[model samples]
Target: MTRLGYQIPNFTYPGIAADQLFDTVVAQAREADASGFDTVLVMDHFYQLPILGTPDEPMIEAYTLLSALAQHTSKVRLSALVTGNTYRNPTLLAKTVTALDIVSGGRGQLGIGAGWYELEHDSLGYEFGTFTDRFEKLEEALQIILGMLDGKRPSLDGRRYKVSDALNVPAPLSKIPVMIGGGGEKKTLRMVAQYADESNLICAVEDIGRKLDALAAHCEALGRDRSEITVSLQTSACVAPTHDEAVADFEAYLQRNPAAEVRRAGTVVGDPDEVAARFADLLATGVDGVTVNAPANGHVPGRVGLLGQTLAPLIG
Candidate 1:
C-alpha cells in the first residue's frame, strides 16, 4: 500500500534569498523525512508555475534537485509531482529515475503525466502541440519507460515516438513505483489502469468519490483490478496550533500568490484535530494516500511535523 506524501511546489518564500532557496527546500524535505512522511515530491518544470508564483521566481530543475535531496534525506521516496513527458525523451527520463533509485537506496518513485504549462513549453523550446498530440506522446513514452524499467530492451515504431532496440542499463534497484497524476477519465485513468502503480487525483473534496468511481470503472473495463492501483490525493493544506492560526497561514499564502485562488472544498486549514477530521473524510472516499502542499509555512521548522503528528495515523 502507498503512504502519506508531501509536495514542495514553490521555491520563492517570503524573505528567503535566491541563493538560500534550495537550503529552504532541503529543510522541508528533511523535516518531512523525519516526520513520517513517506514520500516527497517536486514539480517538474523549468519555470515557476503561474499558480504558485511568477515564471521568474526561483525554480530549480526537478531531477537535479531531487538527486541533491537524495543525499540529504534518508527514508522518504523522491519524485516529481508529475514529470512532463515533453520535457525529456522517455529513455533519458528512465535512466535518470533509475539513477535516482540507486542513490536513494531504492527510495525513488516516477510520477508522470502528459505535459501541460504551455508558457514553459513555448519559452523553453519544447514542442507544445494539441492536447491529443500530447496524450499520444505520453502513451508512447510510457510504453518505452515501462519496458525499460522492466529491464527489457524495447523496440517500438509508434506515431509520436520510435525506438529500435532501446536499452536502459543499471535498472532500478527495486521495482520503482510509477505514479500517474491526473483525473482525465477517458485518457488519464485508462493509462493508470494500464501502467500506473498509483494514481493521483487532484479534484474538489466532493469530487473524490466520483473520480475513484471513474477509475474503478476504467480498471474493470480494462480487466485490471482497482486495488492494484493505489489512489492518492494532492491537497493544499495549512496546519498550525489553532484553527485561526492555520487559516491565517493559508491567507498569508494567498497574499504571496495573489493570482492564486484557494479551492475551499479541496484546501484544508485548521488545528490537528480539524485536519485529522478532514483526512478521515478523504480516506472514506477510497483514497489510500495523500500528498499535501503547505506552501505558506512549510519551510518553517515544525509545520510539516504538525501534519505528520495530526494525520499520519488516520491513513493506512
Candidate 2:
C-alpha cells in the first residue's frame, strides 16, 4: 500500500518565533501519528531562504530534532528528508541511526544524498569537492554503512574517505531502511538500483515518467527487481475548504519565491478529495509514497492536519 509522510519545515516563518515553529512541528507530528501518517521527515539544511523565512533565521539541527521527535510521537517513522553525505562520517552516521532506531523502537529510516549546497560546505569549512568527487564519497559511505550494518568490520580506501576496521556496536534492532534521494539518471539512479531500499525524487509531473523509466532500466542492469525499491516523491501541498482558497494560498506562496519553479510543481491544492485524487495519480506512477512539504510555521497547521485526517483515509 502507498504511504504518506510529512516534511516538517524547520525554518522560521514570517510572523512566528523560532520556538513556536518547533512546538508546532511537534504538535503536527503528534497529530499525524494519530491521523495515520507513515513518516515525518525533516530537511537537512543549516540555513533558510527568504521564502522559508531567512538564511540567518533560527534553524534546528536535523538529527537533534529527530531525537526529540522519537520521544514525542509514536507509530510514525522519522528521518531527515536526505542527510548530506559530507556532513558526517559514514560510521558516525550509522551510529546515529542505530541510536535513533533504538530510541524510536525501530522506526528510523536513513535518507541520505550527495551533498548539493556548496555554500553551506564553504561556510562550515568542509572540503567542497567537485560533484563527481562528492558522488564517489557518497558511494563509499554507502558501502561503509551497509557493511557495518551487516556485522562486518569494514575497511575502505577511497579518494574522499579512508577507514580501516571500523566497528559499530549495538547494531540496530531492526534492519533500518536506507533511502537514497535525488533523481539523477546516471550515478544516483545507478546507486539506488544497486544499494538503496528506497529512492526519492522531487515530483515533476512531466519528468516523473522518464525518471521512473530510467530507474527501471537501472534495476534491469543490476538484475534487481524494480518492485523491490520503494519509489517516493517530494512535493509541496496546500489544502483548504475549497479549491479556490487553497489555490489562492498556494499562489501567494509562489509569489514569495519566484525562482523556485520546481517547488511549485506537483503541489496538491484543493479540498480533501481533490488532494487525494492528485496523490492517487502520483501513486499510479509506481510511487510507493510521498513526502508533503507544508508551509513553514503554524500558518498552515490546520491544512496539514486536514490532509492527514481527510486525504490520508481516501488515499490509503
Candidate 3:
C-alpha cells in the first residue's frame, strides 16, 4: 500500500525555462525517491488543468515521463495519479503499463479513472461522451486491462469496447496493482470493489467518511473484504518550515492561478506542524493513505523532501 504518495500536478514553475522543465521534474522525483514517499504520481493530462493554469501551459505526456523517471529514481512506485480512460485503447494502455513495470523493475501501478475534462477530449479529437457513456466505457476497459495484466488474452464484446485475444508479450515483472480513482458510490466504488487493488477518492476532506462507507457497502455486497482494497484520498497541500511561510506560498499560488480556490475543500495550507494536524484529521476518517499535490511550491528544489519527511511518520 502507498502510505505516502506525491503527485506532480503543475508544471509551470515561476522561474524554470521550458527547456529545463524536465530536469526540474527529475530533481523532485529523485528527492521523493530518497525521502519517505512510497509512490510518485503525475496527472495524466494532455493539457494543463484549468485549476492549475491555462491549457497552453506545460504538460508532460504521462507514460513517457514516468518511463524516463524510472531511470533516475528507484523504490517509489510510478503512476499517473489517475489516468483518463478515453486517452487510448484499453489494450494499448495495458501494454504501456506493463512495459513501464518491466522498465521500473516491478514498481508501476495503474491509477485510472473514467474520463473527464471535456476540453481535452474535444480538442484532442477523442470522443467526449456523457457521464454514463464514459463510465460504461471505463467498465469494459477495466476488464480488458485487468485480464491482460494477469497474462490472459481477454475477449470482451461490450457496447463501448470489443477485444479478442489481445496479447501482452514480455508481461510485467510482477502483478501491477490497479488503482481506481473516483467517489461515485454506485458505479465507481462498486467497480473498485470488483476489480481494483486500491480505491482513490477525489472528494473533500469532509466527504471522506461518507465515500468510504459507500466503498465498504460495495465490498460487502460483493462478499469481498473491505480490507482488500486500500483507500486513498486525493488532496492538495502547501507545507513549509513555518506556518507564516506556508500561508504566504499558498496565497502566492492562488494569485498565479486565481481559479484554484474552488478546488480547496480538502486542501491543507500551513507549516509541517499545522499541516500534520490537518492530515491527522484526514487520517482519522478511515483512509489508509493520501496522495497530495503541492501546486504551490512543489517545483521548488527541496520542497518535496520537506513535505515527505514531515508527513511520513504521521501516516500511521
Candidate 4:
C-alpha cells in the first residue's frame, strides 16, 4: 500500500476572509496533519497559477508558509510540491530546506523541478531562459545540493551557477528525502534514477504503469534499484457521501477551468467504497504513494478528516 499526501494549491477560495488567508491555510494543514495524511505540500510560485486563479490571487512564499505551518502542526511532512530550481541559488535553497527541517523536527522533504512558469519569472524579476537552459541549471543545482547533503563543501563553476566551498551546516536531523517532480522521461526520470529519493508525476492514470516501467529501465541503465525510489502521483480527488456529488464536484472543477482536462483514471471521485475501488487500480500501477489536490473542499472544516476516514485505510 502506498502512502497518502495532500496538496493545497489554492488559497483564495470562496468565503475565505482576506485577513484570514494564512489562518485558513493553517486550519487546513492542521486538519490534514491530524488526519492520516503523511505529507502536505504547496506550490512554489510567486503568483497564483492559471489553473487555480488569476495573477492576483493569494500566494505565499513557499518556505515561509511551510515554516509557519510546521510550528502549528506535528505529524505531516512538509514541502513545496516542487520548488522552482531557478528561483534561488542552489546553496541558499539547500540551507532554507535544512532550516525548515530543523524547525519541523525533521519532517521536511525537498521537492524540486525545472521551473516552467515564465510569467512569474518575468513579473518577479527572475531570469527566464530557454528550456535547455533551465534544465541545465536544474542538473547543476542538484549536483550542488546533493554534495552539500553528504557534508561535502562543493565548489563548482558550472555553466549556470558558481559556488565556493558551499557548505550546508546544521544539516537536517534526518536524511531529507529529495523528491524530484516531473515525468520527462529522457531527462527528468533519468535524473531521478541518478539522484532522487522520490519521484512525483502527474500523468494520465492509464500511463502510470508504463511510466513506472520507464523509470525502472532508467534505474537499470544506471545500476540503481527501482525499489529505492518511491513513486508518488499528484492528482485530483473528490470524496463525498455519494458518487453523484463527487462526480458533480469534479465536473464543476472542469467547468471552472477548461484547461484542467483529466482522464477518469487520474481522478478519484466517489463515495468511500467507490473511491477505494478506484484507488486500488491506481495503486496497482506500481505507485508507492499519492499527493492529492482537493483545494475545492479541503478547507471545509471536517472535509479532510472525512477523506482520511474513507481513504487512509485504503492507502499504504
In terms of TM-score, the best-performing candidate is 3
Per-residue lDDT value at 114 in model 4: 95
Candidate 2 residues 150-204, lDDT tens each?
A: 6789998877778899898888888888889999999898999998988888746
Q: For candidate 2, what is the lDDT?
A: 0.80
Give one digit per residue, the lDDT tens place, for model 3 in 1-316. Answer: 6668999998888889999999999999998888899999999999998878889988999999999999999899999989999999999999999999999999989999998999999999999899999999999999999999999999999999999999999899999989999899999999999999998888866788889888889989899999889998887888888989888888888887887877565578888888888888888889999998898888878888989988898876
lDDT tens digits, residue span 1-316, model 1: 2468999988878888888888899999998888889999999988987777789987788999999999999989999998999999999999999999999999889999999999999998999999999999999999999999989999889999889888888889999899999888889989999899999988777888888888899899889988888899888788998999888888887876885664444578899999999888878877898888888779777898888878788876
Superior candidate under TM-score, 1 versus 3: 3
lDDT of 4 by residue, 1-316 (tens): 1268888888866667888788889988988888798888999998988766678978889999999999999999999999999899999999999999999999988999999999999998998899999999999999999888767899899999999999788878888889999888788999999999999987877788878888999999999999999999887777877888777767776666554563345567788888777777777788887888786566667767777777678775
lDDT of 3 at 195: 96
Q: Please give the lDDT score at residue 278 for candidate 3.
A: 86
Ranking by lDDT: 3, 1, 4, 2
What lDDT is reached at residue 260 by model 2? 40
- Candidate 3 runs further than 4 Å off: 263-265
Per-residue error for 17 in candidate 3, Å, reads: 0.3
Each candidate's lDDT (Cα)? 0.88, 0.80, 0.90, 0.84
Please give the lDDT score at residue 282 for candidate 4.
75
lDDT of 1 at 298: 92
Clash totals for all candidate models: 0, 0, 0, 1
